[model samples]
Target: MLRIRGTIGDLPVDLTLELDDGDWARLGSQLQPAPMADAPAAAVAPVKQRDDLWQSAQDLLRNAGQLSGLELLDQLEGLAGDASAAKRLLVRLRHSPKVNVASGGDTPLYSWISD
Candidate 1:
């Protein structure tokens, strides 16, 4: 049995899955690492786009020096063109070594850390 509990955007998700022996085997096989030689060339585009967005997000904070969580999220949503993507970028920023997260009353304050 597998349980997944999380939220997608404003939606809450609570999911459970039950698998038998055969299903487990199949899932395990699918989870195996693929060979580098078999990797799809077309998959690079999305990865490149994601990297660009990540860089852009970092730049946004660096330029601002500091911003409230809500302010940052709003700008990131505009930059990423999607709320979910923006939230994901924000989370990544929150955990980054170059950023500092501090509690600020009702929201967090994100500040860029200079090296």
Candidate 2:
């Protein structure tokens, strides 16, 4: 048996799960690591800088399809290194014809507009 309790934003979450011996054995088999010879080497991630913020922002929306304004801003902040820069990126995205913004509850959702 396993138990978990956590919070997502203001919402509370509690969960309890029970597993029989057979279930545990099946799960253990699936969890086994692959042999090194069969595994592919991991590629290195490129370091992003402030100058790449524009392209990064575009790529983010392109891949995600849609993201809430707050979520977009949060990701921009990580790429831009500051809230101000993130705001600037937001404005650019708002003005770009390639992107569209729609109201989503408390925040707006930004989406890529494919032509």
Candidate 3:
């Protein structure tokens, strides 16, 4: 027996399914693991793009020398095309050895300190 209880678009839903031994055997057979295939090129492309974006972000900070958190976020958001992506890049920058983060009263100041 399988049971599911959830809400769909604010509507409550409950479902139950009962299966015999033969049915369960067939389902189990269908669920058997398949052989893994090589990863597709599309899957690898995003990683490269992310690396490029990271490099661009570093370059942006390097050129600017220093900027407030809000200011950096604005430029990164534009470069990344998403607020979440920008924030992620900001966090990555915070951890990078080439960048330094200092508290600037109301916001953090990001400065590029190349080694």
Candidate 4:
């Protein structure tokens, strides 16, 4: 069993994933580190083009396909600005147990185990 710590929705949780070495290897193959902005590039992120964080984040995240939870959040935070509302929205999205993934499937997405 491999225990990984990640943030899902709104709460912090420790996920104990039972995986054999082969399974772990397969998962490792699917994961990719996010591209980091170089020097002269701001690290915080940028405001998203769309107003709806849910829709925008979903599309970007899905397209980005295989990324660690931290990478996914880096992209999401890039879309959020310094607005108080935006911060609140991020909090809500991070902590929520279930989110609408827009596939007509209201599944539990985004686990925010990182406070």
Candidate 5:
């Protein structure tokens, strides 16, 4: 038995398959990859595990058709200029980030002050 659920293009969907060899032959290219013994180890981490969260968040926001990046900043600017809330959000984002210095605040935010 195989269970799959997610979006296809702009449409959301779900599917389940219970198959024997003959049934699988019908699926051909559509059949998903076989599960391996290491599948448990491949389980994703939570929000604090930045990589997983970043991709997951992007996907969720994209699915919801929300504005990203520059727009996200513009929305936050409503709260304050150089806002403590924005800085705190960025700090937490950077601390558990997918890459080093994911946001401008990591260095450039402090550049003028230091120089």
Candidate 6:
């Protein structure tokens, strides 16, 4: 069973879905991965651990003193290789005890909350 409730623009939307055994099997089959050969083989680099991302984000904020969210996102994108990953990093930093956020014109400013 799944319940989805949200707003689309100003309109509210709600939905509920229940899947039986056959439905579950069909969904599972659709989610199966392609054969290995059909996939492109790229060199796999070491994954960046969460600790490293957190430390790097902290270092950036500490060194900058303060940065607008856009500026921080840009820097994080350079480090994380994509906007999505950078957004995740920004959210993590926003919740950290060592960081503080304040509105700065169009964008919020992030600063390191030092001990």
Per-model TM-score versus the true fold: 0.66, 0.54, 0.68, 0.29, 0.22, 0.57
Among these predictions, the greatest lDDT belongs to 1
The alpha-carbon deviation from the true structure for residue 93 of candidate 1, after best TM-score superposition, in angstroms, is 0.6
Worst 10-residue lDDT window, candidate 6: 39-48
Q: Please report how far candidate 5 places residue 90 from its true position, in Å.
A: 1.0
lDDT of 3 by residue, 1-115 (tens): 9999999999999999999999999999999875435667777899999999999999999999999999999999999999999999999999999999999999999999975
TM-score comparison, 2 vs 6, better candidate:
6
Compared with the true structure, what per-residue lDDT tens digits does model 5 show for residues 26-98?
7885676656554554363332354543444434333434333444444344433455544454444345323
Q: Select the stronger candidate by TM-score from 2 and 3.
A: 3
Cα lDDT tens digits for candidate 2, 78-98: 888899989999999999999
Write one digit per residue (lDDT tens) for candidate 6, span 1-115.
Answer: 8799999999998999998999999999999997856755442223336568778888999999999999999999998888898999999989989989998999999998876
lDDT of 4 by residue, 26-115 (tens): 888789565555433344433433446666655564565434444555666677644554445555555544333222234324432322
Deviating ranges (above 4 Å) for candidate 6: 1-48
Q: What is the C-alpha local distance difference test score of each model? A: 0.97, 0.87, 0.95, 0.54, 0.46, 0.87
* TM-score winner: 3
Candidate 6 differs from the real structure by a C-alpha RMSD in angstroms, to one decimal, of 10.8
Which ranges in model 3 have alpha carbons more than 4 Å from their true place? 1-37
Better of 3 and 6 by TM-score: 3
Which residue pairs clash within candidate 3? none
Stretches off by above 4 angstroms in model 2 are: 1-51
Ordering by TM-score:
3, 1, 6, 2, 4, 5
